[model samples]
Target chain A: MGVNGAYACVVRTKVASTNGGKPMKDTIFIKPGQMAIEDVDKPTIQAPDDVILHIVRTCVCGSDLWNYRGIDATAPHSQNPGHEAIATVDAVGSAITTLIPGDFVIAPFTHGCGHCAACRAGFEGGCLNHDDNFSMGAQAEYMRYQHAEWSLVKIPGQPSDYSEDMLKSLLALADVMATGYHAARVARVKTGDTVVVVGDGAVGLSGVLSAKMRGAKRIIAMSRHEDRAALAREFGATDVVAERGDAGVAKVMALTNGEGADAVLECVGSEQSVDTAVQCGRPGATVGRVGVPHNAKMDLRPLFFRNTQIAGGPASVTTYDKQVLLDAVLRGEINPGKVFTKSFKLDDIDAAYQAMDKREAIKSYVIVD
Target chain B: MGVNGAYACVVRTKVASTNGGKPMKDTIFIKPGQMAIEDVDKPTIQAPDDVILHIVRTCVCGSDLWNYRGIDATAPHSQNPGHEAIATVDAVGSAITTLIPGDFVIAPFTHGCGHCAACRAGFEGGCLNHDDNFSMGAQAEYMRYQHAEWSLVKIPGQPSDYSEDMLKSLLALADVMATGYHAARVARVKTGDTVVVVGDGAVGLSGVLSAKMRGAKRIIAMSRHEDRAALAREFGATDVVAERGDAGVAKVMALTNGEGADAVLECVGSEQSVDTAVQCGRPGATVGRVGVPHNAKMDLRPLFFRNTQIAGGPASVTTYDKQVLLDAVLRGEINPGKVFTKSFKLDDIDAAYQAMDKREAIKSYVIVD
Candidate 1:
């Protein structure tokens, strides 16, 4: 099949007659903004610990925008793109004893084998036994999850008990929400700390919630967009600075009585955003950045004089344990699903990308039937 | 006086005959190898808690070379330099209670007032009551120390008991040794961890010792110079990698079975040095840099992927408490003075700078008596 016209073919090929010949399912891909829905073979258990997931919901992430915007040049053309996901167990391998068919689970962006050194150390994102990222795109109808017992977290209570909003919030635990929590955790945000979160994206908004949950007394969100800024306040931001760059830092410093924030959360991953986050922090403060850094260079001279520490990386979402976030959602503690400003059907993936790309949506959810 | 020819007017001026006539002293200055030794008005007790010291030993630091090589553009022409010193208390203010005449002390590069928030928090380098750096040059015969009680660490026993080598070693604890300790401590170098020290300067050599003292099992020192590399081994480096940049990183990775060191001490503040330190560390590792960063920019992209934390600043030498190091010196446990490869009389300050600037000396000491 030609790479360009491969998506046009929806032909289903039967691999095993004994299993009633499950048909291949369609999946979305994009080269920058160009989208395609291609029929791919249904995932079959290749390992004893593997599980086949029938994806129910998936969401676009700011990191995905990096590839969609062609910023990540190495991202392959027609590459399957989504990672944050909620799915039902369609099939489980012999060794997968913790989960069974019909179980709802949260699939983290990265999955690790249970026994890897990194996984054992609680940094599954850096798992040695795995490639340290999701093998299959979760935007698809079906995904083959390796080391499923360790990689997928079963949602608490029955799958039928969750409302669409609750499920969306729980689904956020897969990536954005967990990533924000990692940011706050790494920054060592404590009670009464005044935190300044750079970026008003889904991750940044989620950081406000995470910091609040961590007992931060004041959460300052840096945002230029009115809609996102309002959402940031709703997510527990005590203040919002509308400026950018030096002026933004100045505003935060003024708000912080000229000492800068006690902790900074850099969620945007842009050079400017990182710069702002660093500048908005006080002496001996830590800036935890979860953004997939794009040409971001932190000037060590200034940071050194201030004794500032920069600590963060890709969030080990699996280590965060989705059950905790799911429990929080069930108790109405945090509504992370508020970030899902737009929604789309499986086939209308183009609209989802457009809304996110054009800044019309904070985050767009894809509902798969 | 005009800034250019100000140093030429070095004629000593006698002041305060009632307190026993003290003549103004000569001090050295350089703007990119251009040297000058000029007489300046002697410092007297400006504050009630100040103490005047007669400097006995002072050292040239690698950081001073940044200004001496014309790399630090902001460095003033004929600026009074030198901060590391061992001195005898010449006079004390009315409010001074820590010491009287004849007491020997170690003067750190930065002094804290001890009452500020940063000082109270053990970050004396970021003291709010002071300018966060040495107020007087230590290379001169006489210097005034503010916040004397908190800034100067008194030498145990008597001034006459310390040998010249012991005094030099104790002088090192004021800056280089303390800075190295800060680097290792911030990097979280635990027992049995593999550590990489990224420079061969006095600070780097001291870092090797500090790491060893901290119980690091394998310390890798990155150095190309035969003499410094040999000293690195003496300072407890288990391995020495002479290559730089990618080759240096490759060597470290090869030594660690492609996993990289658990912690990296960046004792060189150059961009390349910082980059190598970041690359030489494994996932969840940290790079503690205290080399006075000059145009050092940490690329956050690779660091983010590796989950690397970069934490460091000017070593709060006072916070480390020189008493701990002094006792170690007294017990002959660690000889940090081994770093001083060249010595000079007070008049030969230019030669000291030359030896350090040309890398002929790992560190140079000047006898001020």
Candidate 2:
């Protein structure tokens, strides 16, 4: 299913629901470039660790556009596709102990077993004991949350306890916020550094905020879109570059006194974008590449000669959300939900995807309660 | 003129000699697969920073094999090719103040102004105030060294002050020793880490020593050569895997309990070698790639998805040399010179190149005095 190509790992192991399946409205990928909200069999305990989530808040992600834009191919004609959600725990499997019915929680995009090597090392995104597709079908009335004991992060209270804006911010912790923070962390963004954030997309804007939080002295954002550029500035970008490729590199170099950036976050994974990201780093800079690499290859010799290091991958949603982002959001220290520029009802999920695909919205917030 | 392909950055700034060109025994690259020590015009002061060195000892580097193996094209058929040297400061330039005549010094491969942004940041390899190159023609009776004030590392006394073994040890500091340390530095090899050294040459063997010196808990040297593998063990390798490609990856994985290495040093710049090095790193691991990449391209998507960071370039000879490597050598803490398995007189330089090209010697030491 198109939970977006980046998070579209499918599960082959299917467990029969212990009860007769009830009907519910859930999002599904009908085919490339098309999404549908239809009546489907409501999720139930698929495993001992599974917990049924009554989705309170769900949204369309930037990655969803990859599938809606007809980029990735999948074998199934339709698969329940969604990952981000703020939800109420409706049912808990017997083995699940950390989560129970009526608990207010945010379901991270990735579910990691707490005991895995990657999880213990704080890289839950690469969890070796992962179900690979455990958290899909999240944009619905009810979705089965796997690894509930560890993957579901409990907020203080029910969704009504927070304002609409706060809920949006909490929803962001499910994916993009952590993803952006991952980029900065992997690039080793430290205090007093000059950071270059490529792509003015939601993640890129989030990266601007993350870099700022990491104590970067100056942040240069590469973006051509005016709205995104303005948002980048709001997110703490010191400079915005509209031109791309060599021209973009020239602008960053000029701004950095021909030395380039101390840390570069490559938030757009195209060849041109990645090339610009690498070229804009200083002699000993590290570039954080978090955008789903479409068909980009790093020119190794150039990176080698320039002494640039590149580090990144899928975001450790569980790791970051549990470790810091949740508390930061709760304390109103960050507003990642500002990226959700538009809104749509759960039935209008297709339009949300279209808005993002057409570049009309940085991200689309879905009202799924 | 054949110092090797990697050091063949041709300098176009021709300097006129005040004295009628005096003849000295020097190496010149005649063609691919050939090297010669001929009576050629000795180097003279070309810049204010230039100082003439009475070459006491020099050697062939792994990079030189690039030219000797018929790689990298150049407009000029003959250019002085050498970067590593231990010599006596025969003459000081007018502007040079940091060093004086009769002082024994190690000439680092890359000469930096010591005040450029890159140099100031301890990455002299990417020094902005570089002369493109300033330390070529080092394997000669007498050579002109540029950036004399900061590039020359002074030993305590004249050449006679050190034993033959100590002199060889000091000479290794000019390139290989520091280069090996560079891989570890860039990869962030830390205490209790499992490091993978991918290459069986002098630099790779030196990487084993550097990884050990960095407090790596386990050092895995990927070597097929019996002699080089033994040297790798002597240099602090805990494991030696003679397999290559997929087989090599399996071997390393098995040794690390299928977790792969914490740090990987890509000392061999070929595509196959690089791929092997990358696969041997655990999730979220960093690979230090110091080999001169010859027609090698890093598959960035794989690197990004696996959360691997690739960091490295030309070794920061000045930074590591001035900071720690030289002191380590002088203290008799490391024996990097042991990689020099064979020695040749200045007149037998051709045989030295032949031996290295055929893998008969890990490195060839040249006694030019």
- Top model by TM-score, which number? 2
Best candidate according to DockQ: 2
Native contacts matched by each model: 0.63, 0.64
The ten-residue window of minimal lDDT in model 2 chain B covers: B9-18
The CA-based lDDT of model 1 is what?
0.77
RMSD to truth, every model: 5.6, 3.1
lDDT for each of the candidates? 0.77, 0.82
Q: Per-residue lDDT of A1-369 in model 2, one digit per residue for the tens?
A: 112465554432222343565677877777777777777667778789889999998887776666666667554445545788999999999899897789999888877787765677666666677546336777778888877788789999888899999999999888888889999999999999999999888889889999988999999999999999998998899999999999999999999898888889988778888888888987888999888888645567777777888898877787888888999999999999999999999999889888988889998889987
- Write model 1 residue lDDT over B57-125, tens digit each, in one string: 987877666556765423443445567788899999988888989987888877777766556555677
Clashes per prediction? 0, 5
Task: Report, to 2 decimal places, the DockQ of model 2.
Answer: 0.64
| Candidate 1 lDDT score at position B190 | 92
Model 1 Cα RMSD, Å?
A: 5.6
